[model samples]
Target: MELFFKYLQYEKRYSPHTLTSYHTDLGQFSQYLEQVYQITEPAEADHTIIRSWILTLVQNNIKPRSINRKIACLRSYYRFLLSQQQISVNPMVRIKAPKAPKKLPAFVPEESFNTLLDSFEFEKSFEGQRDRLILEFLYGTGIRLAELIGIEENDIDMRAKTVRVLGKGNKERVVPINDSLLSCIEEYLQYKKSEFSDNNSEKLLVTNKARPLYPKFVYRVVKKYISLITTSDHNSPHVLRHSFATHLLNKGADLNAIKDLLGHSSLAATQVYTHNSIEQLKSVFEKAHPKA
Candidate 1:
């Protein structure tokens, strides 16, 4: 199991966040195997045992999307074992993942974002400046949380008005920045310099203690600020991302262009934002159409 984790870390070059998820999933399965079948190795478990574990998860009301993720982890692990010739055959070959409903990504409305970014005033304190930048950066670049946390001072090219982001699977893409976000970043940097005078961290976003931002910290920041702006049930960094994509699509931005900005591997992943635009069109038609 450790070997498989190392494989994912070094060779597969999976991000720390993704590696942690895989570890957690594999750990749970190993624990299940220990309690149920007394099998120490996940590799030793056959299809019946794996199927039974998945069945129990379903009975426990696990969502199909989450179950599919676990299934994907096992499939990858077994493929690794097969590559090492440690297993004679893949046990996941016969396993079928349940179909998950396709739901549109939740996003903040443009008016909410406009009021937050343009109308409402953020504090003049360093923390306020940083808070504004956090939301603006995510919405501006459409970068993932991990990518935002991993940002270094060197990643931004102020002259080019672009920031380089390392996406999932270690893929790198440069995203353009708007003047608003760029100004926020510049102000935040100046404040950060004064606040952390003794520190010289290269990471773009940091904590009050000058530590690089973590997932939980960023989540709390997003929740706090987003709560002030909108009554939307969703209050995470990804909502800003979805809003970025959705707003762009609504404004008639090209799909391929949005795909490149979002660093998606395929057009299908980017197409989800179009659903929001279609919803917007439906609402407009209901209001403006003369034919009832």
Candidate 2:
């Protein structure tokens, strides 16, 4: 088990959140085996045992999406064990993931976002500047929250107006930035420099005390400001990303271009935004078309 975790962390280069989820899912399954089947090692569990656990999860009212995630974790674990010859047979080969209903990602409207960014009065302090920059940076670049946290001052190339983002699986891509967003970065940099001259943290955004930005802090900042603008359930940094992609699609941007800009490995992942665009088109046709 420890070896498998090490493999995921080092060889697979899985993110911390993914590693934590895998650890938790495996631990839960291991406990279930020990209690029910008197099995100590997960590698000994057969397809039937795996199926039983999944059934138990469904009976416990676990959502299909979460159940599927756990199934994926176990599949990876068993595959690793099989590759290492720790297990003669892979249990996940026969296990199937239950279908989950697809839900569209929630996004903010362009007008609401513009109102938030343009009309919102951010203060003059460093924290205020940092908060505004956080919102603008996420919406402007459409990078993930983790990627934003991983940003270093050197990752941004002002000369080329691009930012190098380390996406999923440690893949790095350069995203272009407009002059307005670039000015926001520069202004925030000036404020950060003056506020934390002695600390000299390489990370682009920092706390009031010059510490690097964390996930919770960023979430709270996003939720606080986003709630004021619109009451969309999607109030996190990812919502801004959805808005960025949806707005671009609504404006007739190419799907492949949006996919590349979003750093998505597949076009299918980027096509979800088109659903929102299609809805917008339906709304326009219904309102403007003379035919009832």
Candidate 3:
């Protein structure tokens, strides 16, 4: 396990968060195997043993998507073992992951977002300004929460009107910013500089005390404001990213361009947004097409 982790850390260049998730998933599976089957070695486990673990997961009411992620962890580990010649046969060869339902990404309506930005009552405090800029930054750049938090002061180029984001797998991409968002960033930076003079932080989004932004803090901030405009129950940071992509597609932006903006490694990953776009197209066609 340590060797595999080192391989992933050094070779795959997985993020710390991703590495932690993989560690937890593997640890959980190992504990389960030991308690249920007295299996001390993962490579010695067979397909039927893996199936029982899957059954246990399902009986515990774990979501299929999450279960699939756990299974992915096992698959990768076993594949590593096989490559190292530590295991003669892969236990996951015939095991299939449970099918997860397809759910469209929830997004705020463009008009609603516009209204929120235009007329929402934000306080005159630094926190309020920071929170407002957070929303606009997420929606404007379509960056993931981690990428946003990972942003440093040096990453922003005011002259170029772009922010360089270090995305998943340590991949870096430059995301363009609009003039409005640029101005908001400028305002927030000025506030940070003046109000938190003792703060030596390099992170772009910091607290009033000039501490780096954490995940839950960002989530709560996004949830608080997004709940005012959206009741879809998914008012998280990623929802703003979805809204950003969906709005772009609706505005006739090329899918490939959107993929680049979102820092998606594959076109297939970005294609999910097309389902939302297709639904929108269907709605318009139903209302406007005269053939009916």
Candidate 4:
């Protein structure tokens, strides 16, 4: 298991959060095996036992995506065992994962996004400037919450008006920034410099004390600010990302272009935004049409 984690960190270059998730999932599976069947080795596992474990997970009300992730972990572990000649066959070869339900991505309407931005008074105070820039950057770039928090000061290119994002698999992509967002970022940086003249932290976003931003902080910021402007129940960094993609799609942006902007590995991953757009269109049609 330690070797597998090393592989994920060094060779696969998965993000630390993802590596942690994989570790947790695999650890739970190992504990289950040990507690239920006294199985201490991957080689001793068989398909029947694997299937039973999955059944138990289902009975416990685990979501299909999570179950599929556990199955993936098992497959990787067993495949590694096979390569080492520790197992004669992979038991997961014939085990099928349950189909994941297609969930529609939630997004704030364009008016709501604008309302949230317009609500920022942009006082010279550090908190005001920082909050404005944080929300602007999230909407403008369509970056994931994790990616946004991981951004370093040097990652932003003022001249090029692009931010270099280190995405999943340690892949890097440059996302262009709008001129308004660029100006906001500039103002925020100036405020940061004035406030933290003695401190030299490199993170793009930081707390009042100049500590780096964490995931929960970002979430709360989004929730608080968005709740003030919009009545929608769904308001988070991811909803901002979804809104970004949906707005672009509504404006006739190329699907592949949107995919690159979102840093999705494949077009399929980015295509969910199209479904949201279609649903919006359908609503419009139903409201406007005079058909009986």
Tens digit of lDDT per residue, candidate 3, span 72-126? Answer: 9898899999999999999999899999999889899999998998899787678
TM per prediction: 0.97, 0.97, 0.96, 0.93
Model 1: ten consecutive residues of lowest lDDT: 112-121
In candidate 1 the C-alpha lDDT for residue 35 amounts to 96
Per-residue alpha-carbon lDDT of candidate 4 for residues 1-292, written as tens digits (9 for 90 to 100): 7887787789888888777788888788788889999998656879998899999999999999999988887888788788778888989898999999988898888986787687656578788888887789889999988889889999999998999988888899999999989999888888899999997888989999999999888888889888987788898888999989999999889999999999998999999889988987898899999981
How far is 188's C-alpha from truth in model 3 (Å)? 0.4
- Pairs of residues clashing in candidate 4: none
Off by over 4 Å in 2: none
Q: Tell me the lDDT of model 2 at 55.
A: 99
Q: List per-candidate RMSD values in Å.
A: 1.2, 1.2, 1.3, 1.9
Model 1 CA lDDT for position 169:
88
TM-score of 3: 0.96
Worst 10 residues of 2 by lDDT: 191-200
* Model 3 ranges with Cα > 4 A deviation: none
How many residue pairs clash in each candidate at the backbone level?
0, 0, 0, 0
